[model samples]
Target: MSNLNKLDFTTLEVSGRNYLKWVQDVKLYFTAKSLKATIEELIDNEPANEAKKATAMIFIQRHIYDAPQTEYLPEEDPRTFWLALADHFNHQKDIHLLEARHDWQRLCFQDFKSLNEYNSEVCRI
Candidate 1:
């Protein structure tokens, strides 16, 4: 196995808009290091809950932003904290989908400088 201390895992801050991508990145990071079980045990506070909680809290804090960081207390169950984020982001995803659909419906080629620009705009949306 690889040395956990030396690995430079990707730092992904959950900014409400990128939760899905963030979660996937984190999972891949841990799995690559064979540390998924270790992380779960730490989050669960198995043998050294307090110390583990402190370590887990720091890790969680580093990967989250603003409201979510404050909303889910570090003292609470880490699973619960993760679940809350998932729920919040899932709802936001639906709203974003609706907005994207609306934006696509209203998009027009006339709004761009040229056909190339128009194609780029379409790709962006």
Candidate 2:
């Protein structure tokens, strides 16, 4: 069933119109500060390990570039909405270009098998 085919636009179900709004708002928020500050904020509120900060940050970037693609990430994926916005911070506060750059980088990678391998390698458990 198509999401739009549903009657109610509310109830944690983000409307397509509202989804665009959220994306726009996110872009605005990220650009209000420097990328470094954005990164710091994401790291500040989220789980982190000493050596995994950069990769975690990258994961955040990919998730935000396309929310649909990242929606299914498990709790331990290290990627989150806030992190993606942080990567968009810039002087002029224009997030489109920065988001595009992140999108480009994200698209370059090949898909992986599963999260278990990621957990074994990254978390060393």
Candidate 3:
């Protein structure tokens, strides 16, 4: 196993609703550092569902920030927390796609005063 002292979990902080990507990145980081066994140990030590949930929350506490002064609650199962974030962000992504489509549909060459400006606007869209 690699030296755990040199690893910084803080660098894996989960910001916004990018939980899926964040989780993948964290897992890869852990694997790269040969700390995958450490994660298994954490899960193994918590036998009961409640214990596992609490353990998960605590394990990820410093690595996640849902809001200002608000972190994942003890009642939240880490799996549930990640799933909820994934679902929420997926919905937001759909909304963003729709907005982009609307904006693209409304874009017009006449809105720009010059050929170069119109080309830039089209490229932006």
Which candidate comes out best when scored by TM-score? 1
Over 49-93, each residue of candidate 2 has an lDDT whose tens digit, in order, gives: 534545444533443334533553443433343443333332223
Per-residue lDDT value at 83 in model 3: 52
The whole-model C-alpha lDDT of candidate 1 against the native structure comes to 0.63
TM-score of model 3 (CA atoms)? 0.44
Ranking by TM-score: 1, 3, 2
Candidate 3 minimal-lDDT segment of 10 residues: 4-13
TM-score, candidate number 2: 0.23
> Which TM-score value belongs to model 1?
0.61
> On a 0 to 100 scale, what is the lDDT of residue 102 in model 1?
91
Question: Which of 1 and 2 is ahead in TM-score?
Answer: 1
Model 1 per-residue lDDT tens digits across residues 1-125: 45543424444455566666677776676567443543454555544345544555466566666567777665365555666677777676687789889989999878888999888877877
> How many times do residue backbones clash in model 2?
0
Q: Residue 104 error for model 2, in Å?
A: 36
**Model 2 C-alpha lDDT versus the unseen true structure:** 0.41
Per residue, candidate 3 scores C-alpha lDDT tens digits across 1-125 of 46643434443334444544566775675567544443443564743355545655555554565561163353365555555555544465666568779978998878878999887876775
lDDT of 2 at 111: 54
lDDT of each: 0.63, 0.41, 0.55
RMSD of model 1, in Å? 6.2
